[model samples]
Target: MIRFQHISLMRGTKTLLENADATLNPGEKIGLIGANGAGKSSLFGMLRGELHADQGEIDFPSRWRLAYVAQETPALDRAAIEYAIDGDVHLRHLQQQLAEAESAPATAANGSLIAELHGALADADAYTVRSRAEQLLTGLGFTLDQMQLPVASFSGGWRMRLNLAQALMCPSDLLLLDEPTNHLDLDAIIWLEDWLKRYAGTLIIISHDRDFLDGVVNVILQIDEQKLKRYSGNYSAFERQRAAQLTLAQSMLEKQTRQRAHLQSFIDRFKAKATKARQAQSRIKALAKMEELAPLRAAAEFSFEFRDPVSAPNPLMVLDDVDAGYRIEDSKGTIGKKIVSGINFSLQSGQRIGLLGVNGAGKSTFIKTIAGDLPPLSGKLHTGKGLVIGYFAQHQVEMLWHDESPLWHLVKIAPDTREQELRNFLGSFNFPGNMVTSPIAPFSGGEKARLALALIVWQRPNLLLLDEPTNHLDLETREALTMALAQFEGTLVLVSHDRHLLRATTDQFMIVADGKLQPFDGDLDDYRDWLFKTKLVAKSLNAEPSPPAVSERRNAPADTPVADNSNRREQKRFEAQDRQRISALKKPVETRIKRLEEQLAKRNARKDELDAQLAAPEIYDAANKETLKTLLTEQAYCAKEIEQLEHEWLEQQEALEKIS
Candidate 1:
């Protein structure tokens, strides 16, 4: 358990937290969230002991181990799995100590030291650490071939994944994850959510992804007005609770206003009639009744609205047999391989389509082709006359002048537009007062994203091509964007890992896979089902299945086969083969499961023995104080080890069941 009593903290000259009181219980998974610059990472620093509170005290056991993802990775020549295993500081230290002891002569002193080190390593679960590290790497989307490669061989994004795997590899009482999904694709994100769900330690994660937060966290710690506030439940629950409170308060004032209108109408109706005096008396009483209801002074939600396009294009673009992807050019100027082929996509006015597929499946390539940022490799691409596109991608945020303010960036987009109008628009996106002039270079990723959207809305585009627009946006900003996109009177094509955003904005979905771009005639639920089956098949066969052919791509479910006896017979034959292969595979898994069950039983029995011994009043005697402490410590350690083993056991069970 951890407690903060009337804590206040600062970063440089800015107050990050002031007079905030909160307590975090054991095994609580908390989502630390706020708008950009609200000091989420600062609070993490305080917990890790790098940042001290200006006032008040933070109370926690000094021996509590904390695990956090490293922001930077060295260009090491070490194997990736070896680097991940190195995160287990205790295990690594014990190994090094044991190695030194074993190098010395086999004296009594050396022997005892070696034995103690070996015991510590066993307690830390050092055995099979390499296999565990490899599992983490695989979950994060690294292939087995990449596990033994040098860490220096991977790119920055892959390095981030390595860092996350390393952080998860470490044993800790508390785990801190900061935007762990930023570098992950949808599949990897799903895998990570499962991993986090199984983590028994207290988890504090900072992320802008609402869906991810809802899946992993049970509580929210929000930073606002220089204070940290705790809210019960997941992100959606918090939103609902907050909304209900706001509604009730506003409804009181609305009720009074409606009563006032009713009274006035009665008075007006009876003013010239025989009941004039009675009506006036009733009106006065009703007006007095209004005093009981408090005034509703709640601040309005900060949101932005996209303006209607000046001209609506019936068909925004037409891709006829398009081959979308980057073309390789050399001295000979010859075009090379295409990523997506036979893409017969048509974007009509008011169409909202969400792009879906695994990472590197050419979703971005198709989007770039439609946006005219990239030309098709070998097909006719036609655009309607006077087509205006508001293309929003992560790279667009980077394209802005680093030294410019939000106001300055807007001015560059619309030079003739009034400055006040631009300021008003930026204010709607939460860039108000000094923020309008502050250099965006110093802004957080979320703030920059908001500004980028603000710039896009200024042009009143007829079509919006957005690729992960909600990547760094907070819940409020994401909601605002969702509302805006839902109401936008234009064609929209979005590529996002944020499912909440996709559900809110997109009316249809398109899957980019196996070199084809086609409609996905199913909702998110069905897509998930297909995804699970696809992964299971790939795992069983040790290879990826190809996508449907171009001719069979549209107007039906992707998994559907023609209703014929021949196809049915072929499907049944393949299914039979899969079942036979799976049954053979399950033998080893079942054997391992049985062994783990036996080990768990033994551990539980020992724990019960300790529990009974600790329950005895004689164990608490003054002479047995050290004995009591040892038993308690060992009990806690045993519980954690068992919990981890149970989690591993479940994963294996799931794999076996997926095949079945």
Candidate 2:
């Protein structure tokens, strides 16, 4: 176990944590979460010994090996695989010793040293280090060919993947990852989730991706109110527990407030009377002894909505037999390379779409073409009248002038708008007071992303194209964006790895793969299954063929059967029929599952309403006893119904899986 005994940490003049104490058990997967600038990374720094506590102490097993992703990767000519292999410092040292021993002059001492080194290498499993490194790279979305390239050849994002691979490659008792999925696509994020689930060590992660944390971590360590608060279970569980705590705290505060008011009123009314003077004084003493309950101060929430577009055409845009890709011009002539071809898509008003694909699978190319950032290589693209597009990507965040204030950026776009109005608008996005006027150079990535989004909302475009908009946002901001997108009265095309955002905001999905774009037949869960099956098929196709058995070879006929082709065709037909049959059987089960899920959601919502009512002090008053009783009865009923519905949902899902 790792223990923090009254730990207080400071970053210069600002206190990040004060009198914080927590214990982390071995092999616990902890999700370290907090708002932006809430000291998540600082806590990690303290654990890594790059920062120290200003008071008290932190104690853990000194011998435990710790591994964390490096913030920067030096440009080097070393092969990517070799760089990952270097993460295992002990194995590399052993290999070096073995090489040096073998190269020395032959002697008894040298021979003994060589033998010992060989044994050490074998124990370290140094020979298989390359293969393990390759697996790590592959899981992180690196292709086989790219693994052999020099580290300096890759771009900045790929370099970050390499750094993550290196950290994963190391053998450690404790692992710390900060936003590991930030640079990953959906496919890579899923892979990392599975990998982290199987990791048999103490793991701590800081991530804004809620689904990723829910799928990987078993415990949540939140940095709130300058303290380290630990909660059992995953992100969802933490949310439930935190909500309960907040409800209870608010209830207690309200009750205390009423008690204090009542006592004060009594003392005020009777303190001057002779008969009630003693009683009033006694009441005043009681009031003075009463502990003051501070009001619960919730974090400032970010909330904004997309202003209605000036005009919305029926069909915002249309791509007729379009080839989406880049056009490269050389000295010879212009050349077009198709990334995704034959895309016949229509962007209708109020359509919400989520784009799904692995890394380098043309998702960006497709989005860029729609955003008019790139001209189609071929085919006609028809735009509806009064079409206005608000496109957001990482580049938009980067395009913000670092020297300018948030107010200044808004003013540039809405030049004629009053300064006070612009400032008020910025406040809705959580940029208030000095933050609105301060230079954004010192802003965090989350701040930059929020600013970029604020600029987009100001445009009020009829069609919005957002690519990974939640990349640098915290959970609160992401939720705000989700709500905004859900309520936006316009067409939306989003490419993101945040599953929660995708599920909540998009009503349909399209997949980009194999140089083709098409509608995905199912939801995110189905997409996960599709990815798994696709990988399996690819692996089997790439696997080496085994030799024929000797007996089978001997039994082979010299002459071919004349009906062989017909028989094979008949077999394929039967297989197709079987697939159709299974699909037919699955349809009703899927429908039931969907219906059950809807019921569960409704019941859960009602239960939440009941819970909120129960938390209010007035609900428990004598006059409202009947109402309180009714609420409790409904809450109980909702709970039972939810349980039954969930069970049915699970059964239907299992049936569908079995059919598949």
Candidate 3:
């Protein structure tokens, strides 16, 4: 258990936490969330013992081991697996001591030391350390070949994964992870979430990704108004609880304002008259000393609306046999590599399509092609006369001038705009007053992302092509953006790992996978199930086999008002075939179950007869002692056999249930 008692924390002149207290119990997975500058990292530092509370005590068991991902991983020549294994410093130390003891000169003392070291090694399970490290690496999306490669060989993101693997490899009572899913794709994020769910130790993760938090964390510690308040439940639950609190606070504030205004009116009407002067004076004094209620922090400052498009054209763009990819520089000449070929898509006005695929399955490429960021590698793409594209990618934030302010950026978009208009627009994005003039160099990733989004909305683009736009945004900003996109009267094509965003904004889904593109006639839940069955639609539509009967019904022909007769016929055929397959699989299992039941019944009957004989009073007599022992042994054997058969029957039943 960890306790923070009357904790007052400060960094320089800013107070991150003031007189806050929280109690974190063992084995609880907690999410530490706040705005960009709200000091989540500072709290983590205090927990790690690298920083101390200025005014209160943080008490925890000193013997408890702590583990956390290193912000940076050194470029080492050691194998990635070995680097991960190094996280278990205690196990490594024990192994080193054991090696030393074994290498020492042969003597009674040395032998004794070696024996003790071996026992310690066994206790630590030092022999399985390598396997455990490998498992962590694999769970973190490292391939077998990648695990054997040197730690220096991987890219920055992969190196971050290595750091995570190392942290997870370490044995600890408390584990701290900061934005562990930032560099992960949906697949890897799911894998890490499942692994963390099974972890027995306490986990404290700081992440802006709401879905990830909802999936893993059981508790939420929100940093609000310089106080760390613990909320029981996931992120969604926290939002509901917080919203209720804000509503109550707003009501209180309104009531206080009304009371103050009514009192002031009475004081003004009577203060100058002699008869009411004393009462008015007393009212004035009371008003002066009254504790005023602070105005509510308006539910969201990040809310901003995207400008409506000038002309909303149906079938905004059409890709006629287009191949989406990049042009590469070769020694001979420039060459084009088509990432997704044989693609056909049309974006109509008010159509919001969520793109689904694996991390490297040409999602970004397709989006880039649509945005005209990259030209089609092979075929032609026809655009409507009034088409306007608004592209927001993760890299767009990096393109912002570090020295220039948001005001300057917006001014470039609207050179003739008035200063007040510009200020109002920036204020919608929470960039008011000095923040509008402040250089973006000091801005956090979330701030930069918000600025980028503000710029996009300023352009009034009709078609939005956003690729991972919610990468660094906090929950409030994300919700604001989601709301903005939902209300935008524009066509949307988005590729993101955030399921909540996908579910909220997209009306339809288009899959970009296996060098091809096609419509996904399903909802977000179906997409998740498909992702589980098929590893991100690894094959082209025609190449892969047809879906199951249930899928066929859900995917009934879109061209027909009702299911066409032929479609119904096909669905019925598939259903029949499914039943046949299920029945074939069930027969043998049912036969085995019947046999187990028969054996159990016979054993139980024999045991009952033996029990009856053993219950006879003469069975306890010395003359019948042998009979009693035999009866007892037989009964024990019968009971054990029945239990074993029942276990087998259960296994068979579970298997059949899964099939059904």
Candidate 4:
């Protein structure tokens, strides 16, 4: 439905996409894969038409519906779940129209017309919307009461979920999500994966969540070395295919290198011979025509070197049955709102704990309380004797001065620390030379994040509290951080969405949920399995889940002179049971397939509407333009989804026919 023809996107001196070409078709779930700074997000921005390519063209059908969830979301006052979800002006307008149509008195002249309109509105699912809105909100990890709370009341991470809900709820054909799984916990991530898998609209996602990629996406589109490569199947399958291709490339390169070396050696030995000179010249020309071979080497290595612990166990932070929650200022603290309470947790030496929960589950609040940013509403928190701690907040990017250099900031914070020591420390975190003196203001979000990390490590605190530390980091940086923390030999507590990082860097898992923290015994894999198997909404929404029902066996005949005809009766009974089982299983598949078809139909209609909006001249209005852009993206996504579902429905139908 959308195609990029020799597209090249350059921002000043750097090329983000170099003559990249690809086609996105209906029913294909594409995963945008690359290392950090590989231009995945930039490419998505181009697709959203938020940024223009320096060269070439992006060709796609006009009037496509598109919805995008950006990396950062606007913070809003906590509002009711129902209010926020249905708050979109357009959706609300539809709701009002539907309501008016239903409330209008019907006379004999217009009774049938009004009745027909009412049915259409119902099918639109535009009115009586609170329940549906609540359902989606709850699916995304909000409690019924939590949904009604002002969005401004939520922390940045929770606010992200609200933003995600807006994107998901928006009527669109194509959905573009950038690192959508960041800041979310195992449960929320699993829930999102299922939601996308079952989603009937087209989806293009840039995520580091391996499990999500494996479950939700059917194809992998990799942008490596500024080139686009496509692979069929999910992440694991793509990895295998990529590995094979790389292996073949390596083998060919090696063989060519050996042949070239042998030829050069022969030429070198007889270069002075008059007769051999002509042959040598011919060999050189032949070699020049061959493509330069890439070296065969293992993927990049993640290594770390850190200062050893200087002291023994130093209890950093102490929580004494501390009930903690942020209280909003309500004129002299007379009236307040509590975010989390009854939180009792502590950090001790040599302890590595992974915090777990769904999005907006108070994981960040728990970390912040420990970090000493916001005081506890009730209960006591004590610091250990001579405790030195290092903290990395989820929004650490906000701490950097946009106008000041990293060196200036570091020197200002620690005047006593020598300049040489600071530079060396920063270098350890991969910031070297001009990078240390570069102004933080122009640094990308990821670079700023790394700067923050570098500054924190310089402190060399025995206690470390990290909240979503891996969120903005690329795979390579994340690996480095993981290694650094694993060898720290100090008390480390982390709240992160990267399962591989969590599993590799921490040993224990603690969940801050339902107003408390509980220890989970199993590992990341175990948590993932439990999430998929136990969460009902996640299960129902999973794209690759088994068919809705399993075939059941039928009842066997009971009477017929058992001794005389036992064998025949037994055979008949088995056959009957088998037939009944098949019938039972077929029923649910048909029902599910029908539901999928209905959703696909609605999405197609939405796509058509979005296409028209994109093609309209009225889109020049700023607000109308933004809305149109969103529509275009959603339309592309919807077209892709419709195709995927249709393929799945066809497969299911075939299975049903075979059994029948």
Candidate 5:
């Protein structure tokens, strides 16, 4: 267990945390949530003893091992996973000692050395060290073949994953994760959630991804106005409860203010009366003693209003067998390898479409092509007459000058747009007063995203093309954007991984698979469901039946008319038998699938328990410690079962397809 008692964190002249108290139990998943630069990362540093607290100590058991991921990049050379895992000098020394002790002859004089070696081995969890390393690497999205590849060859996101993999591989009493899901895709995020669930340690994760938080965390530690507040439950539950508390605070303030006003009125009317003078004086004293109630300021609520799309009778954009890519600039405009080719698609007026594909699958390139940033190779492109499009590219936020404020940017969009009104609008996005005046350069990634979005919406273009619009938005802001898009009567072609946002804003999906764009008549969830049913579930339903007996007696009827009553009756009976068999087989497959899903859920719960236990040094003792080798064997068997279930599910789906 870990607890912060009367902690205060200050950065220069700014107070980031003041008298903040928070308790995190083993197996308790807590989310450290706040706006950008709210000192979430600093809190982790303080807890880990890297940063000194101004006024309090972090209480935890002695000899506790804690791991943390900082928001800033750390210097690391490109190395293989194996090398990285074993690179820690202290751990390597322990491993060497263990190896030496293993080779030494047994003798009474060597007893103490052997005992010391065993303790070191236990501390290192050396019995299943390799398996732990492998699991951590795999969970972080590394394939077996990729484990030995140089980390330098990976992208920034992958490098971050490698860092995360190292943290998980270490046996720590507590895990401090800050925005771990930022660079991960949906699949990788899900895998990490499962891994954390099974981790036998305490974890405090600071994240802006609400979905990820809800899935893994059970508690919320909110930092607001340099104060800390604790709530029991996931992010959603905490939010609901927080809102209720705010409402109550407002009501209490209103009631107290009303009482004060009534007392003032009485004093003003009765103070002149001779008999009521004493009573009035007492009322005055009461008024003096009465505490003034100031309501807690409500959290920001953003409302995005887009300009009405220009009404056009024709489609806004079209691409015909075109190839799109980033071209090297020379005297000539186009010169580069086409990243995506043979793309054929069209965007019509009033079409709300979502672009779905893996990252770097040419979605951005295609959008750039439509925006006229890149010319298509060997194909024609067209835009409807007067098609005013607002495009938000990946680097759209970079266009804002560091010194310019939101109001300044608003003025650029429209010369006469009121500064006060623009400030109010920015305030709705949680940027208020001096924060609005602060240079864009100091803003957090989420704040930058909101500012960029605000600028784009101010343009009021007829066609809105957003790429990963919800990239850095919180749950509330993302929802507000979704609502705005839903109410938007214009063409919206967006790229997003947020399931809720995609479902709420998109009407159709354009799947960019294999360098080709194909329009599907559904949302992201629906597409996922269809893919699962067809590819995973269907395979389970169609197992082969026993081979049919070949006989001359059966062949004799090949040319014969089976329209006779007896022959027809026999054929009907055979058909009914086949139907019954198929139905019976399907029932068990369905049941097995359901059971496997339930088992997965149970495993997740158990994993969470393990995480809590591991996070507590008391729960993790060298004396009563379970053998790492035994745990590894059990974990491996469970992992194998999960893999087999997935494989069998796929095969079952294939069998079902054959039967159909």
Candidate 6:
């Protein structure tokens, strides 16, 4: 067990943990959660012995081995597998000793040392370290050929995965991982979740991904009000318990407020009266003796809605046998090689789609093609009229001007908008006061991501194309984004490894694989099963073949006729034609439904505006009798028009559904 007793921690003058206490039992998988700058990482530092508590002490087993992912990876001309194997310090030491013994001149002592080292290496299972390291690498989305490549050749994100693999490769009593899934894709995340579930050692993870936490951690430790609070069960359970506590606290506070108010009123009314002065004095003393209840403070609270688009055209874009890929040009300037080919898809207004696949499966390529960052290599790409797209990718965050402030960025995009209005918008994204005007170069990755999203939302786009939008955002910001996306009336197509976000914001999923794109007719769990089955099939194909037994041969079915293949092909072609015909038939109805929805939105917006006008006290004055009458008449008209439009919209929707 690990224990912290009266632990007080401070960085500079800011108190991060004040007299905090907690106990972590052996083999417990703990999740450390808090807002950014809330000292979750600082606590990890203390546990690793790199930092000390300002007061009191932490106690744990003295002999326990600890392993944590390195924050930085140096550019080394060494095989990736070798770097991962180096994580096992004990094995490395044994190998070094064995090498030294083998190098020495022949002698009885040297021979004996060599034999002993060999035995120790065998005991440590050092011979299989390469295979184990490769397994780790594979689970983290590394290819077989890439395992032997130099560490210096990989990109930043790939290098982070290497560091994580190194950490997992280490033999330890306790393992610490901070944001392990940030660089991973959905498949890799699922793989890591399974790996962690099978791990026997104690684990502590600091992550903002709710579903990931829920899947892996058995306990949740939250940093609230400068104290370490422990909760049994996973992240979801913690949320429920915390919500209940907050509700109870709020009720008590309200009760206290009412009691204090009543006592104060009594004293104010009778403090000078001869008969009741004594009772009033007693009440005053009672009121003075009451303890003040502080107002409940949420960790972080801010939300901003996407502006309505100026126009919403049905079928926002269409791809006809398009090839989404990068140009493979040299000095002579050749056209692009196809990463994904024969892509025939349509993006309709009000559609919410999630894209899923393994890493390097052309998900980003498709998104870039749709965002107009890349041109289709071979076919026509039709964009709808008045189409306004808000495209967000990781590189968009990198494109922000480091020297400029959030205010500057907003002003650059909205030059006609007032400064106060821009500032208010930035505040809604948690950039308050000086933070809005200060250079964003000093901001964290989460802050930069929020700024990028804020800029996109201000554009009033009809179609939103987001690729891994939740990468650097913390839990609070992610929740806010999920809420905003849920409420967005425009079209949304998101590619994210965050399952909670995808599940919350998307209604359907499309998969990119084998140089093709297709609809995924299942939820996230089914995707996981599919990934597992795919791996099994790949493994079986790679394995050596074995001869069939006599009984198995007897049970095998006879071969079909050669003509059957042609017949099956014809059947598939006919099915494809039927699907196209149905889609063509549905288009008109879908268009009608979209137009009706747009009209309803406009009318509802106008009705809201009129309702706000009618809420004013001046609208009821006698001097404005004629104005009031006109307002009333218009309000009634709006109500009736809204009713009729809603009915028509519902009918159109039903008609469209029937066609589908």
Evaluate model 6: give its lDDT: 0.85
The segments of candidate 4 whose C-alpha lies over 4 angstroms from its true place after superposition are 35-37, 49-65, 70-116, 146-160, 183-186, 236-251, 294-305, 314-320, 326-348, 358-362, 368-386, 525-660
Q: Backbone clashes per model, in order?
A: 0, 0, 0, 47, 21, 0
- TM-score of each predicted structure versus truth: 0.76, 0.82, 0.77, 0.70, 0.70, 0.80
Worst 10 residues of 5 by lDDT: 544-553
lDDT of 4 by residue, 1-660 (tens): 878889888777887788988888876789999977788888888888888888888886667677876455555564757545553545666557646754677444334444444444444544435655776777667787788788767778777777788777777778888888776766777667777888887788888766678888998999987888888898879889988998899899889989899888977887789989998888888877878887866666444545655564556677877666666666576543455666566667789899876665678888888888878778789887757678899888887788888888789878998899888777766667998898878777777888788777667677788988777776567768877887887788898877777878898887665566667656777566545443432223432222121122123444434555677767677777776766664666677778878987897888788778778888745545335445544655566666666766776676556546
lDDT of 6 by residue, 181-264 (tens): 999999999999999998898999999999999999999999988999999999999999999999999999999999999999
Error of 3 at 217 (Å): 2.3
Q: Best candidate, TM-score-wise?
A: 2
Instruction: Give candidate 5's whole-model lDDT.
Output: 0.71
> lDDT scores for all predictions?
0.82, 0.84, 0.81, 0.72, 0.71, 0.85
RMSD of 4: 12.6
In angstroms, the error of model 3 at 576 is: 5.3
lDDT of 4: 0.72
The lDDT ranking, best first, is 6, 2, 1, 3, 4, 5
Model 5 agreement with the true structure over 1-660: per-residue lDDT tens digits: 787888888999989989888788877778898866678888888777789998987898877777765343344454546644753445778768767865788554454565565556655555456655765675555666788777667767777777777677666778889878766654456668767877778889987677678878988998888888888999889989988988898999989989999999999999999999999999999999998877677655667777675566467878888887766878877577777788777788889888865544577887878888888766889788888878888667666787887677777777787788888877866678998877788776668888888777766677888877776777667878888899987788887666667777887777665566666555444454343443333334443112122220123333456968899777667666667755764675667657767776776566555555545666334543333323433444444455555655665556555434
Q: How do these models rank on TM-score, best leading?
A: 2, 6, 3, 1, 5, 4
Native-structure RMSD, model 5: 11.2
Error of 1 at 536 (Å): 3.5
**RMSD in angstroms, all models?**
9.0, 20.5, 9.9, 12.6, 11.2, 26.5
Tell me the tens digit of each residue's lDDT in model 3 across 1-660.
988889898999998889888999999999999887789999999988899989998888898899999989999999999889888888889878867866777565665566566556655756456756766775576766888999899888889988888888888999999989888776677768878998999899998788889989999998889987999999999999998988998999888888889889989999999999999999899899989988877555567888889998778999989988889998989999989998877778888888876666788888888888899988889999888888997578888999999999999889999989999989978898899999999898889999999888888999999988987888778889889999999989987878888889998887766677877778766765665434312111113322333343253333445357887777667667767866755666677778888998898899889889977898766566446545655665566667667877886787567546
User: What's model 3's overall lDDT?
Assistant: 0.81
